[model samples]
Target: MKKQQQLYKGSLNTIIMKLLENHGRMYGYEITQKVKEITEGEMNLTEGALYPALHKMESEGFLDVEMERVEGRVRKYYKLTESGVKETNNKLEELESFVRNMQQIMNLKLS
Candidate 1:
């Protein structure tokens, strides 16, 4: 699985939050498409993982859900709550720090 590669598995929440942070709100499918678009299909987020994380965030009060009718079907959109906004910022910082550390650690030349 793409999630098992490198350190991406841990950053799913960060990735979702950041996308919601930028896009304001999105449904599960939209989030998956966006990730694929951004990563050029390198990363694939499975439905099992995405929905559970979304539900967990919803339960944690980090996300607020809005239901809308589109194409004769109800679509559930997830928006970041006030607490989610704060959490997103924190997660972003944490991810950035980790990336920088990894970069530095991997910068060594093989002699």
Candidate 2:
């Protein structure tokens, strides 16, 4: 029930990539729920946003999707491709650097 906002656009991909890195493979709903839980409800991703990113990543060869029949529904599970694993690491590093720069600019310390 959280509203979608512009700031969440690019970062969702990184979050998904990181989740896949840790969780191995997961379905769409599971990904959404996990993100919500991990962020303590601060980040809420809509299917509209999530599916496109998943599909885009798959099309780009960053993710591999496998369909499995579960209880009458086809659940599309996603995992990182080799490229995705590399990309995840790079993105995380980039995010870390960005955070450090922001901290410097703001003259803030994490203590």
Candidate 3:
């Protein structure tokens, strides 16, 4: 795997939650495309990876799913639940802390 892909694999859930938190709700493909767009195509989320994570989060009560008919097909949308919002904040905090530690260890300039 490329470096970016490898790095992103560890934080897919946080990324998805943050997106939902910002966007309200999104279908799977929309989430994938948004990630691609935001990352300038450096990151591509495959269905194999995305669906399982969504299902797991839904089961864990971090997300809720809605089915909507669009263009003669049913699309499943994912939205963050109340607990999800809290978890997203926690995950973002953890990620930020990790980054700060890494910066200090590497003697990198803080942002």
Candidate 4:
């Protein structure tokens, strides 16, 4: 499970995009909590990693941010932009292909 969790680290961006694609919009902390809940505590996203990824995606034009004032503080929520949706679809297809290839290789009969 630890090894598998490491593999999941590479898919962080894809995971975030997919979640945003489904949920419409989410704040940074909310996204982290959601991942933790879905993974049942196996995967925890640290601030150092998650924030940089979000910032990079935002700069790449894959995400749009909406800032809201809540209790005298501003919260930034992220949602998929048009390009993000397209990128998410492409990434999902690529991930499926990669998984299939891995499965085939693992199933090879070698004496």
Candidate 1, run of 10 with poorest lDDT: 1-10
On lDDT, the leading prediction is: 3
Which residue pairs come into collision in candidate 3? none
Model 4, C-alpha of 33: deviation from truth (Å): 0.7
Please report, in order, the local distance difference test score of every candidate based on alpha carbons: 0.92, 0.91, 0.95, 0.94
Poorest stretch of ten by lDDT in candidate 3:
1-10
Q: Which segments of candidate 4 are over 4 A away from where they belong?
A: none
TM-score of every model versus the real structure: 0.92, 0.89, 0.93, 0.92
- Leading candidate by TM-score: 3
Per-candidate total of colliding backbone pairs: 0, 0, 0, 0
> By descending lDDT, how would the candidates be arranged?
3, 4, 1, 2
The TM-score of candidate 2 is 0.89
Q: Mind giving the per-residue lDDT tens digits that candidate 4 earns over 28-107?
A: 99999999999899888888888999999999999999999989999999999999999999999999999999999999
Q: Which residue ranges in model 2 land beyond 4 Å of their true spot?
A: 1-4, 108-111
Off by over 4 Å in 1: 1-6, 109-111
**Per-residue CA lDDT of candidate 2, range 1-111, in tens?**
234456667688999999999999999999999988987987888899999999999999999999999999998999999999999999999988988998798996668
